[model samples]
Target: MRKRIALLAACGLLAIGTAAVPANAAEPVFPLVGPSALELPLPVDGSGAREQRLSITLDHPATGAPFAGLFTVDLRKVAGVATVRDHASDSSHQCTEKDGELLCAYKGLPVSLELDVAAAKGAAKGATGEITVTGKVPGATVTPLTTKVSVGGPDLVMREMKLKKDLRPGESQPMPLVFANEGTQAAKGVVLELGTTRGMELVETYDNCRTRTAGDLTTVLCSVEGDFVPGAAYELAGDSPLHIKATAHAYDDVLRYGIYPAGDEPKAAASSGKARAGRKLGVSPAKSAPAAPGLRASDLNPGDNRREFAFHTENTADFTTSPVSLKGKAGDTLSTAFVFENKGPAWIHAANPADSLARTVVVVPEGAKVTGKPQECLAVDADGTKRAEQLGAPRYECALGNRVSENEKVVYPFDLLIEKVVEDAKGSVTVGDWGTSAPRPHAFDPNAGDNTAAVVINAKGGTGTGPSPSPSTSGSPSPTPSASVSASASASPTAKASTAGTGTTAQGGNLASTGSTVGPIAVGAAALVAAGGALYVAVRRRGVRG
Candidate 1:
């Protein structure tokens, strides 16, 4: 019994010792300490093109003799066109697994990974993929650290734009274009290029606080005068639209170049692998589409019992038609029809009967002629410009009365008799009329006219005489408001002018000497305007009319 008891005691002691000695499981293992995380650079505010880097500099969690060799790090996946290039040291050979961590003692093995990101111009802006870094332990499982690759901070931004479409040949309109920078850094250089449709020419270009007329063809290009700072907006007013081809190319002189840095050396161009081919990477501007055109004017004829007096006008809100084009040539006299629309605000005040009439002009080529009394509603200037009197003029007033409410607009339509004549003529239709009341700011772009309808005139075919000649009418025509004029009523001048017979006179009225009341000059001005319309109308008719 004593021997058995001694043997049992020895066996129990040996078992306890073995348990305390610990198996391989109790030994510290390399790379088993914790998961790895990443840090990324982003913008304080959201704007501009994004370019950023992914940073990795976290500490390892575990330490042990088994983690004595090198490890590998790589990106697991990438979407879109993003790519990793010039990778940091691929292997960590000199790493030491000591204490409770894995440490790379030399710079040859990168402690952090850096990469240059360049989103393609058409590339989507956002996180493109994930990166995984794995640390290997000679006798233990490989540990992986994962992070997301994100894009942030923009380089350039578009602020505002004034673009127009569907311009007629030889036509030009003005636009106000604006730009800005929303990045943390300054932009070095900027340039704007002029593009036109195939048949259109850039009539004029203006910038830098100046009135636009004709631009110097030689120096038509525009460039930024100074470096642009973040959050700064630049404006280029007086840019005009031209009638040209649809596939025409309009872009910056040089789309992109080098960027200025905040401090340190400027970042170099991205590697071939970093560049993407089809990504949209920047903010664009918003714009409005073009308005539809007017109907043809000279198509009015008295066919059978139905009388069709067709007249067209461009860029006007409303119009009224008369049988004038068919008057003398019509075999039968029937009622005419008119079509029109009111484009501006519903509120506008006008006293003239024609103010409610929609007017239209049938452009007569310089040589065309008509037979019957040109439509009674049609008014002509000394030079030959045709004005439709039946169609009331558009009223654009600030306030219904003297108060500033909403901007106002009104459209007028008219009807006229169709006249027939025989003569070679060409012309375009003028749709809108100048109001008797003071002129207001034009609501739409000048070149983006409402509609231009082409017309043909013939005495035998039922067309009105081209247009009437200047009237011997009296009283000053309403004046067109200027840019200098203020929209507010308080800004209106308190002066008044009344004309007595031909002699000059000055009285208590605050009417300052405006200028001469040369009636013929005004008539000539209207005629010249009519002639321009005639030319455009003839061009379109070549395809639609015989």
Candidate 2:
């Protein structure tokens, strides 16, 4: 019957193969037994006792008949076993002490022999040991096994420092520093060194700190008097707050020194017997012996060992706009150019292409209709209306493209049709109008007077230029206007005036001013004179007939 049950169990095991099935399917079991490897902790201070839970599992391959066996743990190499207790309900196991070793034996099938082990006093840290197991089964082959156990020691790690606030020049601020012992053992005789670059100075003093200044840099070496316990922090700010200030822009560096458990020394030294009295051994003695047991200081790990932080002073930017003036007849088209410049200790950078740090706004003069503007300019009224229908006065907000560096200037040209005669048609052009607002806010412009410039438009053929010429009523020729009557006579016309100038300025720092020149005015004035003479002759004949 037992053999029959074993055959049925084997068939069931075949039904459920090694493939992972749904949770509903029963898991397959195997006849595997072993003593697991151990990782035992040994303190660097060697004070606290450590414990490791030991167990051996015997899984039954076929589940029908219980197979009896003798399972034993032969602990000969390991020395620190204070107590062992069986966890199984079936009381068939016993532990015996034999020749400074613990031997445990159990008799069961599909059993787990669980035991609790406590390290004995003075167990060496970083030492290696092993445990062997033997299993004897009635109808199975029991293989002997050996497993290694390593003793664990302390691991030391330093925590990084973070900036709590922005560091500024001439102002002393506390920089928080912290280090931690993340290992199992305490770190002894901890030391920390904080160094500063050219412009930074240290103000506070702490215990065991020796300050030394070499050239423009300074170093403060601090020794922590107490032992840093495991999982505890040594804060530099606890005893005395560390205050550091930069005379200008500078960086600070920090390094830590502490003792941690280095792994065990070599177990054996290589050697050959020395030469004998008469015969030559032809071998040298051992070169050196193993090192003594202790902790080791921290070594530099490229990515983890060092840290740096920096601070800076304030920066200023000054933007200025030059004056713009033009002269044009009542019906003539006028193009006036304005230049905006930056005199800065710092470059105004646009965070992105669309974000501008500075903007120029040109206020359109009255009596002058805006006919043309650069593509970068968006024509809008003061009430945010595009191409304002009411047309009292319109303004064009132009973008001065990214990074207006020191001594850099941006030129804006405007095309206007002079509708009616008005003397000194004044308007305003300004840079950095909005302070820290949309488009851009020039937060650091110290001088507001230079940011704005007046646009003076002198209307030609007005009362100030000369007396008004008599209107031709009858066949009387009109007086010829002066050769200097054109606005171009005052300013030379350039190619830029004929064609709309580009949004960006030229390569050189100089800004090319667009001349106020009208091309069609000379031709239009000649036609006007001839038409007036013909109208005067016809009106004289009608008067004579009446």
TM-score of each: 0.21, 0.33
Q: Which candidate wins on TM-score?
A: 2
**Which sections of candidate 2 miss by over 4 Å?**
1-312, 350-354, 386-393, 433-441, 459-491, 495-546
lDDT of 2 at 320: 75
What are the runs in model 1 whose C-alpha is more than 4 Å off?
1-154, 205-221, 237-546
lDDT of 1 at 336: 15
Across 387-478, the per-residue lDDT of candidate 1 in tens digits comes to: 45422222111111111101111111122223333353333444444434322223331322443443434434544432222221222233
Error of 1 at 233 (Å): 1.1
C-alpha RMSD of candidate 2: 24.7
